[model samples]
Target: MNKDIIYKDLDSLLNTLNLIQEEQTVIKRKLSGLLDHVVPNHFIDWAEEIHQQILNREVALQLLRKDIIALKKTIVQKKSIIYFVNNQYVKLIIKYKEQIAYLENEFKLWAKVTAEKFDTIVA
Candidate 1:
């Protein structure tokens, strides 16, 4: 793949991540508000832990976004070079992609479980 294309993709990914982070902030606020009214219980504690995990994931994603930005700059400077399979930047990109995928899936599952639990309690 062309370096220019890769840079563009990285920039796009960063934009998407920024949007996701904003959404996550909204979600966290909602969860916090919901937790505030819920009676103390083991399930509530579990939900709080999940919220903490979400915060940790946000921090991790922020760091990853910084790394991606740095990598994009490096890609621009190394325009003449071709990335081989052994390239560190390529490996890092793959790792970030995998992490994003894993986190997204986990978030979806957590949302489903939280909704189900809240439904049972509220109903």
Candidate 2:
């Protein structure tokens, strides 16, 4: 791998990581809003359905977090492989990082929407 290419890829990876972090921040904020609206009175007969939705969201969120961790690991590994030199692998790492961020954001949106629907049903 060319030294110049390695540096360029590293820079691109860093930018992608920053974008992922920004996305994560937005998701956290949305989730927080959903949490704020949770109420016990909303459960009733629909409790079972609401519970299922919550459970599903929990599982999805866990998976998204796991993917984020894996992306971080891949980034670290790619950096090591580059060893301060340019490499072609950086593009693949960036793609995965973007994908992880997208999945995380998608899950967060789903969770938020589910919570809102539950809230409406209970209200």
Question: Candidate 2: TM-score?
Answer: 0.37
RMSD of 1: 2.7
Question: Candidate 2: which stretches are off by over 4 Å?
Answer: 1-43, 80-123
What is the Cα-based lDDT of residue 87 in candidate 2?
43
Candidate 1 lDDT by residue in tens digits, 1-123: 776667777877787677668867766776677777776787588777878878887888888888888877777666465552337877888887877777677767866776676667656
Q: Write the per-residue lDDT of candidate 2 for residues 1-123, one digit (tens) a residue.
A: 554554455455455545545554554554455456654544433445544555565565555456545644555565354442344345555655575567557656865775576457546
Clashes of each: 0, 4
lDDT of the candidates, in the order given: 0.74, 0.53
**lDDT at position 102, candidate 1:** 75
How far is each candidate from the true structure, as Cα RMSD in Å? 2.7, 7.1
Report the CA-based lDDT of candidate 1 relative to the real structure.
0.74
Candidate 2 colliding pairs, count = 4
